[model samples]
Target: MDQAPPRVQLITSDVRQRAVLAGALLEAGFGVLSGPSLEQADLVVVDGALPPSELAAACAQAHAASLPVLMLATSTEAAREGIAAGADEYAIIPCSRQELELRARLALRHARARAPIVAGDLRIDPARHEATLAGRPLALTPTEFRLLSCLASNAGHVVGWQALLREAWQVEGSQGGRQMVKTSIYRLRRKVQRAAPAAVRILTIRGAGYLLAAGSAPPRPPTCR
Candidate 1:
């Protein structure tokens, strides 16, 4: 069976920037759709200069339609605003070609990774899209679900802050200029802690990101390995 090229929708008003980005992506083998509309896109990238009203409207529409959104920012302020407006990811201006490609791939990868929360009794079933802690189901927001899923998938490895944001929030370095990812992480941690016991840890790596020990499951399973 033939595979379809990844679909990317770029919503930049700047013709030159759009042309450059679109051309680069197309050259690298992606199905590029450049426009201002958010409908019919697996990934939506919004320009930083988009008016607040327009940004909010587009975000609401995308969220309602369950489409993942990425924002392109020219400044830190713009990036913060984009995150607040509900963009799933954000890329910044003057991004390097390598960074752009990495971010694009990360966004697409995370998009595919998104699934329903399937967690129970310290077990998370990404395949089943279910999550549970202590034999009980958890009511995690989409963001929290992604955050936990990312941690679960990488088990023993320490996930970097930028990497976690990329995977969980789908936001690359472009839109994650300052505390956007941190704020999300804090919220995610708090939510998880609220539902779990103090001993069940979600360790912070200080200058790094987070870690979730695979066998850290409560009531350690005999066959945890």
Candidate 2:
């Protein structure tokens, strides 16, 4: 029997943004440990708009842990400083959710590629821009791949619709103009089902959002236990 992967630890500044980011990662399936205090983090992701003293402190803590640092900077100059201070990566915030997921996975992958492989049947080769289930290729549209990659990276957690839209579509602001997210999820489900076992699932939480089921269970509609 195989064991599940350990969760990713996330540290961020703004509570609202942290909540949204946490939910997104959870829906994608990572056990998230959050703190405004970067000293306690395994992976410190900080706001670039923060004061230099604070950002520098966060970087110091990350360096102490030997943990990778990702910064959400407000400007190019800030990003440069973050790198100079030892951040592994820096990106502008309000980015599409797809970009976020891709970069996050790459960061982890770069860190753990030689550690050991914990992921299961789903194989995402970011470099190839491709994914396969149990060695069988999935016919995923590019958008669907980005969405699935986002969710799969944090497999056991719940991802909200708004975050998904931002990542998958790159549309900005807190607006829900259409319910096309549901449509994309549905299509992703069918594509995965074609090759995955019945036990693996993509569960939906009412009023919360969608997430891939952990382990091999096929996604079930949300249920009350």
Candidate 3:
């Protein structure tokens, strides 16, 4: 049997822009739903021009639902703002219809690729965007969850910096991308330490990339006589 077309929730206050985006997505074989409702939606496309508060709220709601977000921004700066606000990926406004379709498809593809990862005591559930080590939950942001997922998916292997950027941010050759990876990795390390020290380790492979290795469980304390 044929599968149903993916449903997309398009969020933009501008009627004209929403109409245009809806047209492009429909032409690309996607079902479009307007408004803030995320029900039955496979993906979300947001307008960066929305008030910062609105944009952030939209992205947060989508992520909370385990849905992927694609933001349409007016410029690179706006795109960065969208990403910082929790968008999974972005496209500059006034882009070609082809590019828009491609980006929407890419976002859906990435979202579908998320499968649970189990490396030793570390468990990552991409569907729920949750991670835990040694039965303790690790508080992680959306970006951090993506970064950890990428590393754990390739556990024990050196995953290059560019690979992390592409997997986590869905962008390649971005300026300051390396630094962004570094900063997020630092945060992930701290969280891991706090949750279950030595149960998992994200190691830097000097000029190579990062590696996610599951460490031996911590030693148990001696019992009182």
Superposed Cα deviation of residue 116, candidate 1 (Å): 2.3
Tens digit of per-residue lDDT, candidate 1, span 74-168: 88889899989987777787887666666677766665656443323356656466677766666777767777787766655567777766776
Please give me the total number of clashing residue pairs in predicted model 1.
Answer: 16
TM-score of predicted model 3?
A: 0.55
Stretches off by above 4 angstroms in model 1 are 34-40, 117-225
Of the two candidates 2 and 3, the one with more favorable lDDT, higher being better, is 3
Best-to-worst TM-score order? 3, 1, 2
- Candidate 3 Cα errors over 4 Å, as ranges: 115-123, 126-225
Q: What is the C-alpha lDDT of each candidate?
A: 0.68, 0.67, 0.86
Cα lDDT tens digits, model 3, 1-225, are: 999999999998899988998998898899998556798899999999999999999999998898999999999999999999999889998998899988888887888777568988999987677899999998888899999998888777788889899988999858899999999999988998888877888888777788888885332222110
Tens digit of per-residue lDDT, candidate 2, span 1-225: 865543556655577888877776666655567434544444556677777887888777766765666787778888899888766777677776666666566656554432222246777766467777777887888888777777776566677777677777887434442377888988888878877765346767778788777465455443211
Between candidates 1 and 3, the lDDT winner? 3
lDDT of 1: 0.68
TM-score for every candidate vs. truth?
A: 0.51, 0.45, 0.55
Give the top-scoring candidate (lDDT).
Answer: 3
